[model samples]
Target: MATLEQCMTALEGFVGDLAARPALSGLDRTVSCRLTDLEQVVQGRLVNGTAQGMEAVPAGPSVPRADIRIITTSDDLLAVTSGELSFGSAWASGRVKLEAGLRDMLRLRALL
Candidate 1:
């Protein structure tokens, strides 16, 4: 498992990468990454091609679902963000799970 700080850093980099992509310029959505092993969630909103209000909170029923939800372990989160693991492969292997509306899924598939 990755430390909380490490996971936060990885997510920061992930958001930075997403923000740099022009294809996502018009995309606006709330995103949450649930770290299973750590039992925490990193929540934020992706707007204007950037992520805002990124924060980690304990995993529980009180954590509201976002427009885009990602569930995975902390180490896997780091690996995916760092390019050590491909998102598609991870999803296929059941290491990562993604949930979203059909339209959002289609739009995100092309960029994520």
Candidate 2:
């Protein structure tokens, strides 16, 4: 049971790394990360590859539609940050789900 704070810390680091990548420098998008196990969603807007306003949203179906969506369990989220699991592996194994448009997918190839 990973807390939202733990997930936010890990995600800030991940997004910060993505923001620093030259390959992602021109990318801008909004993202939603859903922790299904915890029934929580964190939303953020990315401008020039830097993420901002990342915070937990009230659990609901109605919210601003994100350009990218990431769905995963809270335990897996914790595992990835704790070095107990690899993101690529988890994604490949269907433990993590990433939904994005083709263009965004191409731009995000470097991170995912």
Candidate 3:
């Protein structure tokens, strides 16, 4: 099983590759992950085609930022990273929870 750091690294690589495409250059967003049963939260910003790690500060209210929140167990993370789990199917099956604004959700769908 991959550690959270390893999983994060993989995700970073994935996003980096995706951001390299000319069509994806303008994407800017924030993603927050609260791993199931874990106390740590990972927050980062994807801006101007680069993902910059952000301080793990609590989000303020009324901020106009597209936020993607994911809550899943460690096992689920492993499954997702290994391609053994499908996010759409997991989301539909209640294995994952996603909350986002409408436009954020749409942009996330396009990016992913």
Give the candidate number with the greatest TM-score: 1
lDDT of 2: 0.81
> How would you encode candidate 2's per-residue C-alpha lDDT over 33-58 as one tens digit per residue?
89898888888877786888899876
| lDDT of the candidates, in the order given | 0.87, 0.81, 0.62
Error of 1 at 55 (Å): 0.3
TM-score, every prediction: 0.93, 0.89, 0.69
Which one is best on lDDT? 1
* Clashes in predicted model 2: 0
From the highest lDDT down, the ranking of the candidates is 1, 2, 3
Stretches of model 3 off by over 4 angstroms after superposition: 14-24, 54-66, 110-112
Native RMSD of candidate 1 (Å): 1.3
Query: On a 0 to 100 scale, what is the lDDT of residue 45 in model 3?
Result: 70
Model 3, span 1-112: residue lDDT tens: 4466765765665446545666657877676656554544556776787767843333355333337676676567667656788777777788777777887566556534
List the pairs of residues colliding in candidate 3: none
Task: Looking at model 1, report the run of 10 residues with the lowest lDDT sum.
Answer: 15-24
